[model samples]
Target: MSSFKPSMSEPKSPGSYCGVPAQRSSQWGPEMVLVKLEDCSHPLELNVIVKEEEEERGIKEEEEEERAFTEEQRAVTEEAEQRAFTEEQRAVTEEAKERAFTEEQRTFKEEAEERAFTEEQRAFTEEQRAFTEEQRAVTEEQRAFKEEAEERAFTAEQRAFTEEQRAFTEEAEERAFTEEQRAFTEEQRAFTEEAEERAFTEEAEERAFTEEQRAVTEEAEERAFTAEQRAFTEEQRAVTEEAEERAFTAEQRAFTEEQRAFTEEAEERAFSEEQRAFTEEQIAFTEEQRAFTEEAEERAFTAEQRAFIEEAEERAFTEEQRAFTEEQRAVTEEAEERAFTEEQRAFTEEAEERAFTEEQRAFTEEQRAFTEEAEERAFTEEQRAFTEEQRAFTEEQRAFTEEAEERAFTEEQRAVTEEAEERAFTAEQRAFTEEQRAFTEEAEERAFTEEQRAFTEEQRAFTEEAEERAFTAEQRAFTEEQRAFTAEL
Candidate 1:
């Protein structure tokens, strides 16, 4: 018989395992390369068949021996000793025959029991053999399965090791490529670092410039605010000063008015007292003249002539006193009217008041004519009256004192007094006009200065605002430039 053998170095091929005819007709797939047997027959049936064959052979041998023995015995003893033996056996009897038959039966029963026991032992042995063969086959199958599992595990391990080696080779190639580019990368990194440093420096400078611009703008704004505040304070001070000045001017005007009123009242009282004293002197003079006239009439028998002279002189003196009073009253009224007009002109914007001017001029002319007429009449009447009285009553009026003549108001003295008063009033009015003009000019100047200051402040504010806006725009543009530069880098 040919046996299948497998090699350890190489793998097996696809094939079949089968037994020869009359030996074992076993079949198996390609994987079962080892030799194997088929299942055995039932041992009980084989035991029954063996027992029958053994019994047949024993019977046949027993029959052949009995036949041979019967032939021989007949040839040798059938003619000689049969009668005497037969007579003796016959005399031996039936009890000995019975003992011999019992012995044979016991022997056959023992032999049959022994044969059954042997057959049972053989069946038990055959069953034990079959069980052992089945056990061996199972053990072999388990071993094969274990070996196949081991082969698969080894194959997986080899694949894993091969992948690890390939990965190591690829890493080595990558390291070589990286080494080749190291110089260029190092130079590029250095250049980038330098560029970053320069950009940082430029950005810092731009930031500082922006900060400086901001600081300057803030300083300018602060200065502008301070200047504006100062201007405001100055304006307030000027307004306050102007108010105080106006109050002072009003007080001065009130005081001047009060002084003028007092002066006018005193002058009027003095003038009235002077006129009364003059009238009393004239009366006394008249009484003296009448006494003188009566004496002449009594001494020389002069009758109606002396009486007529005394009455005529008295009438003339009375008329002269009345005219003087009238003239004084007219002068006082004219002066008062002129003073009122001048005051009104000072306090009003009446430069074009032509009617008032014309009226005042006409009134001044009328008063002047009246004053001249009164003065002429009074001078003429005084001269005439004085000449007649001195001539007619020279002897009697020789007692009149020279002091009275000196006390009398002549036309030249009155004219000189009026001229002095007029001059004083004109001078005072001129001073007031000059003062008013100065005050008005100063107020106008202050207003103009305030307007100019306001314009200057507005211009300065506009300039500062524009400067700040320009600086902010420049800062934004510079920042954009820096950002663009950084992006390029």
Candidate 2:
């Protein structure tokens, strides 16, 4: 018998023939045979042989068995080779399908990346165009504003110049009028002062005259009172001397009456003495006759002669006293008559002086009243003259004030007219400024609308271009995939 050996061309998988095992044949001696593995794509064959001593006695039987085994082995080798060839063809077809799918995926990714880069470029160009347009519009607006400001400044300068000229002329006119009014007021004040001075001087002179007249009247009154007092003293002196003379005359008359009574008594007594003497003689004669008869009557005749002598002497003395008393009474009566006449004269003079004094006092009172009336009339005349002067001054002042007011009214009217003209100019300038502002706003609105319309048109065109590019890329990818699929088939 021979041991089994195997030959390999290349390395193979470990479990390629997992289900097949080795077996021995009973009819044949112990020998190795060449056998092919079945599950592998390539045929694997091995050869072996066996030798024996009793083989001549059964030679025919062994020769027949060998021929049958050779035929069976050849059939198995052919079947294994056919199955390996089918498996090789299926593996080559699958490799070609995988390479086609990988090429399609790479092309689609490259197309998508190119589309995104183009979109970014388009957006950048649009942003740059919008910025340039905005800068141009800003420059144009600045130029327009500069021109409008220059025009407004020119108008303002002209208005200021005209206003300054008007103000200068008005100031000059006002200064001239003020000077003229001042001079007129000064003259009026001086005239009023002179009139007041004259009135004051006249009043002073009248007052002095009134005072002098009053002094003269008072002096006259004093002199009249003095004369009346002196007359009264003289009357009183005459009355006293008359009263003294009357008292002395009455005393002398009383003594003379006593003397006259004595004289009458003496004459009567002498006659009585003579009668007695006669009676006594008769008696003596009778008695003597009687005595002579007796003694011769010698003694009786002597006694009768002595008695008659004594009686005659007493009678003569009484007659002288009566004649002296009669003379004294006559003188006394004449003195009493003279004293009564003197007293009457003194009373008459006092009465006359009192009447004269009363008359003088009445005259003085009348003169004083006349002087006061004259003074009052003079004062009234002075007051009337002063009132007339004051009225004239007031009239002149009123006329001057009216003239000044008229001039002021004329100046005020002129100023009001100038102010009205200035207001009109200001209103016109304000209206012009409003018109310019409205025009500027209208222009800005029109420019903004135009810019919006242009931007909308550009965006629409960009969108259409992007859509066309995407459609073309999709068509090219489809054609490439179809061509690769056909080649694989």
Alpha carbon lDDT at 312, candidate 2: 41
Candidate 2 lDDT, 37-140, residue by residue in tens: 55457655443343332563276356447645754664566456445544644554564455446546644764574456446535643554464355335433
Q: State the C-alpha lDDT per candidate.
A: 0.47, 0.44
**Index of the highest-lDDT prediction:** 1
Off by over 4 Å in 2: 1-89, 145-489
Local accuracy of candidate 1 as per-residue lDDT tens digits, 46-122? 00001233554576578558756765664455334445445644544453466447546744764575466447545
Error of 2 at 396 (Å): 94
Query: Could you tell me which residue pairs clash in candidate 1?
Result: none
Root-mean-square deviation of every model: 86.3, 77.5
Clashing residue pairs found in predicted model 2: 32-48, 34-46, 291-294
